[model samples]
Target chain A: MTRTRKPGISRRSTLALMGAGAVTFAAPWVARAQVKTIKIGMPTILSGRVAQLGTSSRNAVMLEVEKVNAAGGLAGRQIEMVIRDSKGQPQEAARIARELVNTDGCEMLLDGEASSGSFAVHEVARDLGVLCIHTCSEASSLTADPKQHIPNAFRCVRQGIHDSIVGASYAAGIAKTKGLKKWATCSPDYAYGRDTTGEFVLYLKKFAPDVEIISESWPKLFQPDYTEVVTKILQAKPQALYSCLWGGDLTSYIDQANIYAMFTQMEVFAVNMADYTALTVVKNLPKGIHSGDRYIKTFPPTPENAAWGDAYKAKYNEYPTNWSWQNATAVMFLNEAVKKANSTDGKKVAEALTGLTIKCPFGADGTVTMRADDHTLVGYAIGWGTTIPQEPYVPDVKAGDWKTIFELEAEWKKSKGYT
Target chain B: MDLDALASCLASPACLVTQTTSGLIIGMLLFLVAVGLTLIFGVLKVVNFSHGAFYMFGAYFAMTAYQLTGSFALAILAGAAGTAILGLIFERVFMSRVYGRDVLMQLLVCYAFVLIFDDVVRMIWGPEFKSMGMPAAFQVPPLFIAGGVVPPYYLLLIGVALAAAVVLGLGLARSRIGKVIRAAAQNPGMVSALGINTGLIYGGVFALGGMLAGLAGALAAPVRSLTPGMGFSVLIESFIVTVIGGMGSILGALIGALLIGLIRSFGSLGFPLFTEGLMYLFMVIVLVSRPTGLFGKEVA
Candidate 1:
């Protein structure tokens, strides 16, 4: 037999290289001996229509974890992520929350995007007295109501109420700019829609006291045809349109309106979640299609959001939407809480999270803190231009798909504003 | 209610044109998805609960093809072929067995496909939503219409759907194979008695329907994000289109699609909340007033 070993390194040398590789890999694990491994749970929509949001959230959390571990591993302990797919279902969320707390031994938890899921996780966290950091669930009642179940629940993002607060101001401003003070309201027939629209109209009344709601239409979410509603709207012919519709509904609506020149006929259109994903879907929209140039996003603090946004796109191949960014902030805050407490105990972490001040790139003033009461963060609202050309940073074919035309940094001057 | 408010909306040509174009795009997409569903239902008499699954397969297949070849057109073609094959297999192995069964059984099998396909998709594509980068040609400026830019693709989609309708319509009337299939659809027993392989005809119709669905999905891939529930949305929308257009009637499908397209365009601006409700209300009214849709055949 021909000897083939002449071209290769000695077995001893190969063994030495293997030994070195093993040691190199084991070095970090050994160094982590002194540090306690802290496990955190994130129950989120990992599948279905809003799966993208969950995936982005997970990607953002992973990035933050990598950053924390790189920087001494969250106060000398390597942080571990115990991610569970919620599939956008509340029941799945509840089951996952229980598993994370009981089976996975997670010390803290991050909330999912959907309100139902968050509420499910919130219920479990309350029962177990575990720290729950909520990012996406915007149902204000979750945080506002004290009598509700979640004792350990804390929201790290702006409530859906901010939709109304910001939407009212934004729409009023648009109306004033275009001299279109009269408006009609159309919204998905749901609590989130109703509340947001009601609040928006109420706030708009403050600015345009004489503004009239010419026509009101409430369509069921996911219903396919909009002919009757369109007929009604055309008959009324309001100068501007206000809608709290988001997700697939908004996307479908935009597609429909563009065909009928509704965008052109409506001077200004206000969608609470318009600029984030809806605008993204209709990227190659007709040049003349303009919804609202300015928006009030519940997440993202500044234009310098490039770092976090870049990190997300690098990993997920998509920009972090408002929910993704918010979730990222919430996860970082959870890690910070563990660091501040110096332990992974949920109660200790919760105590540390309460009124704990931290620098957040996702928030205005480069800083945000968990409120002792209600737990909602005084986060920023990014105003985006749905009609402007897309930016290079965003995933658009060309640079002019969308423009961040305006942003409202939700910050108070320390004592005067949100801390 | 207020003249000033309405006046502002009327004054802005940009908003109006954009909304109209948007509606047309939506309507065109609806037509694409609906026409396929209508065709399958017309010939197979199987309601096709899993029509959305075919759509999903198309999107995922297109995503894969795009990833492998980096060609949008090739990806679309691959997607359509893949879906057609899957549809043929489904017809032969599963759907064909239940051809003479109740419509409920057909729905049940398709529903099972929905679950099975969802998991299969997860295994193949993973749970993350993927985007197929738009072709370079589509990235350019759209046709200028009344000083506003209209997306070239929206016009392309409309053109494609119209061309497809015309071709399919002509083929159904003129082609020998199409004539045979139409004969079978009109009278399956008679076609069988005439020594025609009705089973083959059924499979062929199903495959064609699947291909159409795939084409719709492939076209939508660049325009819409690919997610698990994408097919469900399309399925519902297609059902609405079919019903509105008088179920199983190609002309009815086209008319219904255009009507929906126009409605969505105007309603999103004028009545956002009631957009969906209005659609269903119309369906209800149509069912109540005219059991046979505006273009549907009257029930015996």
Candidate 2:
């Protein structure tokens, strides 16, 4: 002990060493303070048939993020998005969401998954207790069903029930005018497809009692061959066809249907066909195909909407899809929540997000509200119209009434035992 | 359980005719893909897991060619030639090294190429699905056959598949190159000693297989949506066809493809929910009953 004391530094030297150690320990904290960043994890389907969904969502989110960052970020803390591809798999989506928070140090989650992947990500958000905003999944059960609802999660995209109510109302008018009674459906065999199609049929029947679904074909998601499905639809010889097949599936279905001249035979109403992705790609896109206004530069009928669409197209060399606006709105809502809360804490930000309303280009009246009850978006543009091959594909649009949409949505939730 | 519904669907002549034609269309497409896979296995004794990737590349190449030349015929030629060249290079560089190696080693090598080609396709063509609209020649209203409508493009595919079957079957039976290929497959050492370039035969056979797959892809481009992973489903179906018909047998591939196609079409009508499962069920039954397959020969 005596030898050790002799070898050790004197009081002044010991003090100097202690000071150096303290400086070393405090350096990281000082650096962190100087360069603070709030990371948000985005789990999306970036690699399969729905890759465009993720690409467009990321483009929109980044567009908003760039604007916010340019204006000096939220409370001087820059936002860093850590995006991961789920490969269109549900388990992978859940795993990536967990990894984004637990391992990658993300403070929040921006879930850009489709319905199946979204459900898995929802569970992950609940387990991790992180704030999550669903920007793409439209399946009503995600929010309307209390069993699936979580305190920290919200949806910025349109819901299935809302879409069904609006679509049925629009289609009923056409059905009456055209005297088209018999109908058939060919949707992807999945939750979003089945749920939306069922809701649509249920509401279609309610609105137009004369309409009957004579045949239904549920093709596996990303099914390569539509020959059999097209054949079946042709055999049924329905006056009209209603399909919820989306993204590549919808494009493929339309292309294959054209080969058999199926569209010529029936009045096709595809809920997802109006978006530019499908509109621009389908060869000789048959005219007069009725579709929900997924995303169009003109439907919102605002300078802001047009400006945003033009800017996005200019930047990405591709027109934005329904997902792009929803995701951009999600970012806007998140930014507002962060500003209002003035804290990066998940609980505080979440509480601030509850029922938050913000001005957006995609909103029905230049403003959208995050409904307090379901934590889902409302007051956004909703409509159906006929498609043309050229630009301004859907010229005449019929907008959905949010008031009626809400009333019917509540009843739908009640019927599903989700109230 | 719904006997009336089933009966009504089956009872309709138009329905039966349409379904049968649909089956034939699908069967012909499967034959084009399976024939290549079986040929590769027959000569190389390698499963060629990447055959599907070749098919995908064929479609992409054909698409690019069609876009550039606006000639579907030229596109088909470019597709088959491009994929054959790719197959030749792959055979010379990677496949050549694994000749006479362990079965696992061969499979691993082929599987590795599949992954590589998949990524390559995405990098080149991108992940978005694409469509080559049916050529102007086949864009007319569908041809009616026995009260059922058939797309003109599908009829073209059927014609091309039948033509290929006749040419390949006869070529293998009597052509000089075909005799050499068969001889090499039977005894590579003896063929090599007889001054025949067995390596060249192997390369040629592999390229021919790739060409057939490529041709199938080009024909299918109009009807099937083109994606980076589109080949995988067709590959699985082709494998099932080969297994049911007898691996390494062209006749077997044709028969198996038709059976699977008919089963799928009818299965969808009878049991819509289990159409995919029905294919697997048939494959399972075939495997259980005949491990050697309908036309596969004993190795010993």
Candidate 3:
């Protein structure tokens, strides 16, 4: 080979010289490029009955990552995500958080799971000093009181308290108009379920003083056996039922309760009955039942939401769940904060995130604001509507005033001693 | 103690009737699952950890069959037959290897199937929960029971499970092949020496167990929600039933299931928090007195 290349400065030596020159010139650029990338760690529930929660949130994050990367990445560096499955286990969630921070070198993290898992990650964030945005868990206590607040953590998901305010108001209004009382509940037996049910009932009592919670049943989450609960609710003979059962539990309850004609007698107010996935599984979703979407596209029906929904549908071949919007909103806040700070420093970005207002696709007012005090999202469109046989599950999606919610949240926060 | 509570219970005969009916219905469904577990343990000498997963497959299979044929009867047949064939294949391919091996080998095989079946479900059904769509022609409407309405579909589920229990109970005791099975369960070594082809008995019993599980799942699919981990939940309850009733005893499963069902049905009224705990309490009490479980084995 050397002899053949000797006539024309030896082909091997010529190629080697060229390669060496290229390496010499390109080495710095590659190293700089590697340094320019931002890494985010995500711990989520990626298995079991509520697997959809994590999967949807993951999809939403990927969608945002794509959008941001395509538009030249977060802070001029290419975006990278390190996702870990929590398996919906709280300890696993905490372990993954620590691993992502220590082993994976993730500068930022996202913890979007059920309350049990999310709370664990919140503790990790507090201890490890990693910036975290909770994308899904609606437990108000996670970010409510100042004494228990984690400065490193922020939540982009709608708070349970906010939902209660809107849910109770709508329920109270509906109850007043329909003259329905003697409410019962069938909630998942856990913190989220209990809190959501309690908050809704507590606020409902304040709104409609005459409401009586006649029967209450707490079925284990992901437990499909609702026969006993249905029978009890039927026996209680409530004129109306307010439930916090969501996702599969909600679907199971609806189907089981329908079998016993539980719906025929009671005016049902299920907090999360308007979800697309839940609705698809339900055979006979009565037209007049009051329902609300945690993140339904058709309800808002705005051009922005329509576009977002279409895009998400095109990507996933299904409707994006409420958690998807929540995580996407979270991604938006992250992107905006990182851009605003012009730094990937967790503390700086978090400071920028405090009280940041960003355009959201689903809100009625077209924007969502992050409150500085609790680091919770506000300005979310709030209301429940009567179901219809059309595109949007609920037609005339009743809208609520965010200002009123803001005021109530402030008072509640004050009560929590966060103010 | 609480006279007011007693009066309330007495006053609501409808509630009582509804609870009893539902309890029996649920107990019968649990019986279907637990009986399968008992049968498999009886003959195979292998604790099938994947039994719940097999039940889940039956529901999925029935769901698919119903979509294809649009006949509930055909769906039930499909669920049973499909699961039986699946069991046959699984036992032939995997369980056969571990037969005559240590308990650890058998347990490992079952666990491997559990993982495999779980993935198979996620692969086949995806992560979304499926509905077997309740139909209008489901025999009857919510039947008026005292003062409460008993869901019409519930009667169908109860009838199938009860019929299955009776047929299986009689088959295991009265039929010729059934006698061989009982013999094998009692003394597989003796049956093997007696030229009964114990392997065939194991396969048959395993297939039968799978069929019962499938039947329960298919019937439940229309009533209960179908999801990935449902098999796990039902399996937990089935385990409790088997442990309490005696692991390898079919009749014991029936009694155990009904006991748990009644507890769950009425326990919520007295102590909602302790409804689940009561099952364990019963298990602890029974096991304390009789370590081998109620119908597990005769004292040596």
All models, DockQ values? Answer: 0.14, 0.56, 0.55
Instruction: Sort all candidates by DockQ, best to worst.
Output: 2, 3, 1
How high a TM-score does candidate 1 get? 0.73
List, residue by residue over A1-419, the lDDT tens digit for candidate 2.
35555666799999999997888687976666547888999999788667887999999999999999888776667889999999889999999999999999998999999888899999999898999999998887789889887889999998888889999999999999999999999999987788889989998999999999988899998887788889878887999999999767788788778878998899999999899988887776889999999999989878998999999999999999999999999999988988899877889988988989998889999999988888999999999999888989998889999889978877777887886
Question: Which of the predicted structures, 1 or 3, would earn the higher lDDT when compared with the native?
Answer: 3
Query: Best candidate, lDDT-wise?
Result: 2
In candidate 2, residue A250 scores what lDDT?
83
The sequence of per-residue lDDT tens digits that candidate 3 reaches over residues A1-419 is 35432456777889999997888687976656646788899999888767887898999999989999998887788889899888899999999999999998999899877788888888889889999999988888778867558788998887888888988999899889988878988788887888888888988999999999877788887876888778767766889988888877787777787778776788888879777788767766666778766767765768888889789989998888889998999888988998899877899999999999988886668888888888888887667887764567776778876877878877887877777
DockQ: the better of candidates 1 and 3: 3
By TM-score, the candidates rank as: 2, 3, 1
TM-score of each: 0.73, 0.92, 0.92
What TM-score would candidate 3 get against the native? 0.92
lDDT at position B210, candidate 2: 91
lDDT of 1 by residue, A112-219 (tens): 658877777787887888778887887767776656535477887656555555556656666677778667777888777787777668767876776888778887
Please give the clash total of every predicted structure, in order.
48, 0, 1
